[model samples]
Target: MKATVERATLMKSLGHVQSVVERRNTIPILSNVLIETSENGEIKLTATDLDLQIVESFAANNVETAGSITVPAHTLFDIVRKLPDGSEVQLNAADGRMAVNAGRARFSLQTLPRDDFPKIAEGDLPTSFEMPSSTLMEIIEKTRFAISSDETRYYLNGIFMHVSDDAEPTLKAAATDGHRLARYTLARPAGAEGMPDVIIPKKCVTEIHKLLGEAGDNMVRVDLSASKIRFTFAASVLTSKLIDGTFPDYNRVIPTGNDKLLTINPKAFFQGVDRVATIATERTRAVKMALEQDKITLSVTSPENGTAAEEVSGTYSNDEFEIGFNANYLKDILNEIESDTVELHLADASAPTLIREHDKSPSLYVLMPMRV
Candidate 1:
């Protein structure tokens, strides 16, 4: 294979696919990316780690001969990345090595046979829809932070996505890591009426987020099946396996009787939580909050680090009470609320609390209180 692609174009496409290639792999081929010249005169780059895969295609003006080859992903990415931006890149594959030439620099990378590269199964995608890329990005950014990190509770290790119909149809993304839960929703697109509920793994959500960040258009197409999901936009396609577990009924965890109300500035709340958490112990990251009369106080005490307290002005008209929460959880939830004011719907000190943005963008958060 011989082709001359602009350095910037080649590097950008490589950057898009390389994230799916893991640095450490049991199989040598898994560490490499598959590159081939398509029949339509486009360069196709593919990378996968069994569960998730990404394919990106772009055009090159000069073509010598069309061929396919596999080479180390990171190594190729770095080589192209360091090359002068406007320089022309010449790629040629002969014998068992792929040669890259640009300006005065040259690189020879060992190539593996492309036949050994595993292809992800498309299966049968019965549900498909397209939505604004910005809308889809908002749903993921607002909810994915709560995805569980613990492998034991594998079900909660991804975003739970589905379509819900009440008075109006809505598409929602939800995630929880036990201490807190986040749910974000948008108006359901026209063709997503019967989409199946699926748990999309954390890694896939992450890669999709990155792709959306760089997408140049307003829309992204999503195709869903029982076991897999595919996202397509521009010349890139990402396919991933659904997490093999059922997401819990998250609606039941949202408290309805949490009537006590407290309104606070989110920026202030996030700063207060962060400042107080400094004195908190590593084991507990705990912070105590007290509501009295007209002022809200945040306090942290650690056996080894003494104690710290700060007061932040807020509006609370409920009975005076105290609540304990993981300082990190409080900060994270507050950070996600991108509004001037946030409201906390509370039942009591021991019950789960609901945090809502004053604008109420159909996103909600539930934070389970901890004993300080």
Candidate 2:
């Protein structure tokens, strides 16, 4: 394969592909990226770890020959990243080695046969839809933080995506780690009416977010089956296997009878919780919230670290009550709130608390209380 590509363009595409290649691989070919050239003036790079795969293509004005080869993904990415800006990179593969040259820098890397690279066979994808890249990104951002890292409950390690028609036909994305849950809803896209519920693994969700960074003003095409999902956006394609477990019925955990409401500036409330959390125990990291009419006080007491408290004024007229919650979890939920004001609906200090934007936006959060 002999092809010339711009340094910046090559570096960007390499960055996206290399991220899918694992640093430690039992199979030799899995650590390398497959590079292919075509007569249509395009260079394609593909990387995979068996479970997930990413392919990206970029225009190459100069293609002396069309061929395919595999080389160390990280090494190639490093070489392109350090190359001089605006310089063209020349790649030539032959005799089981690949030569890379740019200006005064020269490097040779061992190449593997492209036939050794594994490909995931995408069966008939009965469900397909197109949605704006911005909307898909928003869905991932709002719920990914709550995805569980616990391997025991393998089912909770991803965001659950499905279509809901209970109120208005909407697409919902939800994630939870048992202590906190986040759910975001948006109008269902045109081709998503009969889509099956799927759990998108955490790593795949992360890669999708990164790929969408360059997808300015573009729409993302999503195709899926019961076992796999694929996303296509802006000269790139990502395919991932779905997690093989059923997500719990999240609606049961979302409280419906919480009537007490407290509205406060999210920024101020987040700052207060952060300050008081400094004195919390390292094991629990608990913060105590005491709410009353027009005022709320956040306090933390640790035997080893002493005590800290901060008073934040808000619009709450309910009876005074104290609730305990994980300080980090509270701060994480607050950071995602884009609105100036946030509402927290409470039912005493023992039940799960419902939180959302003051305007009742489509996003909703449920945080379970802990003992301080």
Candidate 3:
């Protein structure tokens, strides 16, 4: 394959495709990106790790011949990244090697047969929808932080997304790690209703987020099946196999009747929590929240270290209550809440607290209390 492409265009597309390629792989081809030049003057880059695949194509000029080859994704990305700005990059594949040249910098990389690249066969995407990039990004941001890292309970390791077909159709994204859970809802897209819910794996969520974040003002086309999901837009496609486990019923855990409300400036509250958590131990990074009248004291005690506490001003008038929670978990929810004011609904000292935007949001957070 021989193609001359603009440095900036190739660099951007390589950056996207390379992220999907795993750094360490037992299979040789999985570590390389599939580069193919078409007769129409478009060069396509594809990378996959069997479970996830991404294909991105960009326009190129001065194509002498049409062919396909696979080269190290990261190495190629690094070459393009370091190339002089606005320079033309030439790529040629011959004799089992790929030559990359830009300006005076020249490099040759080993190539794997393009036929070795794996492809995900998504039979028929019965469910399809179109969502704004901003909305999809919000959904991922609000819930991805709570994805479980514990592999034993694999079901809790990804975001659960589904279209709620009720009186008001809505799209819901939820995630939990047993200690904390995040739920975000948005208006349902036209073609997503009645589709089977899918548990999108954590890595898939990460890659999808990276792409959408870079995509400014672009719309995403979502296609879903029982076992796989695909996001296609802007000359690129990201497809991943669904996690093979059932997500727990998230609604059952969302606390109800937690009436005691405490409203505080999220920025201030988050800052105080972060500051106090510095003195906390890794094993038990617990923070005690002592709420009474209109003030809350966030305190952390470590036997090896000393005690650190901060008094955060809040709006609470009910009976005094003290609750213990994992400091990191508390901060996780606080950071996801975008509202200026954060509302914490408490039942008592030992119940799950609901953290949400003060002005009723479709998104809500549930944090289980821990003994201080």
Question: Highest TM-score, which number?
Answer: 2
**Measured by C-alpha RMSD in angstroms, how accurate is candidate 3?**
1.2
Tens-place lDDT per residue, model 2, 197-315, is: 99999999999999887899799999999999999988999999999999999999999999899999999999999999987777759899999899999999888888898999899
TM-score between model 2 and native: 0.98
Estimate, for each residue in 1-372, the C-alpha lDDT of model 3 and write its tens digit.
898999999999998899888889899889899999998998888999999999998899778889999999999999899999999999999999999999999999999998778888888999999988998898999999999999999999899998886668888999999889999988888988789989999999999998987888989999999899999979889999999888889899888899899999999999999999898898659999999899999999998789999999999999987899998888888888777898998998788999889544988999999998
lDDT of 1 by residue, 1-372 (tens): 988899989998999899899989999999999999855678999999999999998998777688898999999999999998799999999999999999999999999999999999888999999988888888898898899999999999999999999678988889999889999878899889898899999999999999899985668999999799999988899999999898999999999888788999999988998998998888768899999866999999899888999999999888999999999888888988878899998887789999989544688999999888
lDDT of 1 at 191: 87
The regions of model 1 sitting more than 4 angstroms off are: none
List per-prediction Cα lDDT, in the order shown.
0.91, 0.94, 0.91
Error of 3 at 330 (Å): 0.8
Error of 3 at 115 (Å): 1.7
Better of 2 and 3 by TM-score: 2
Error at 306, model 3, angstroms:
0.6
